[model samples]
Target: MKALLSLALLLTWLGRCTGAAQVFMEPQLRARAGDSVLLQCLFLDPDSKGWTLHKVDWLHRAGAGTQEEMVFFYYSNHGVPAGRFKHRVQWRGNISRWDGSILLQDLRLNDSGTYECELRLLETSSVFMRCEGSAAQVWGASLLLPSSVTACVPSAPKPPGLCQQRGQPGPGAC
Candidate 1:
């Protein structure tokens, strides 16, 4: 009886240690100015138990000493983008699919930096039968854009003589 109880305790300790070391996936993304990029954050529920995503927040940092700014926040099925990024960021993730990705549109030169995704999970009796605590998983990645790639802007229309038709090459007739 004593040996059986000791073995059970050892197994429980090992399980907890492993669970505490869970890792969040981060993939480096590269994009040009004016292109959209998706920063992904996905994790595996070790015990096969589900969790209720309470909040999702994305932060951005340009360099040292600079405060990490909140780029986007999503909760209660609504997404809010920060100040200047209000018209550039979008929530492209699905809670049911365990995806916490965000789409950054119209990328600018200053957008080249590190982006972090933080996911807060809520405990519920229905899905998470035995949650230890409110789990906040974070994943981050760096985005790089060449300096030569400038933000795309609308250019003035070309002369009618230089215009070309659909499938046609050069500045010739259709």
Candidate 2:
């Protein structure tokens, strides 16, 4: 009986450690030239204890044939913006809250494309944990600037009732 009890406890612990989290962002975003846009990357961690954030990287791709450019990098409480993104990218995220969002100011026509956010999490012991989540993308524009634009739509189909469970009305419900 003691052995069975021990096995049960071990299973419970494993379940807690393996709980999955969802990392998402505004699947699509639109901003005009010279405007500013916020690319929100949020992680809904299933573990109540929360995980330690190790780093976050943001990349951008201009078009189909273009290579992805490293736009931003954050680690050890420091942020670095690369290339043309220097001085234009702002770290608006908080590690404590699992928010890896960012703000891109002074948008240019060449910035019209897709942006991706990559995140890494670590265990309390500072050991690398398995990365298990999806990324979000943002689409930029240079024409027909809207005075005030704030919208988010999932880029792909999510599990039914997941958004509702989060008190969100799901895509197109906005």
- Alpha carbon lDDT of each predicted model: 0.47, 0.53
TM-score of each: 0.55, 0.59
lDDT value, residue 124 of candidate 2: 37
For candidate 1, list the clashing residue pairs, or say none: none
Worst lDDT run of 10 residues, candidate 1, spans 2-11
Q: What lDDT, from 0 to 1, does candidate 2 have?
A: 0.53
lDDT of 2 by residue, 1-174 (tens): 000000000000112234334543343344545777666666564344456667877777665567878888788898888988998999888867766777888866566545656666665333222221132222344233212122112235665656665566774442
Candidate 1 Cα RMSD (Å): 21.6
Task: Give candidate 2's TM-score.
Answer: 0.59
For model 1, how does the per-residue alpha-carbon lDDT over 43-91 read when each residue is reduced to its tens digit? 3343344445666677776544567777888877888999778899888
Error of 2 at 130 (Å): 13
Clash totals in order: 0, 0
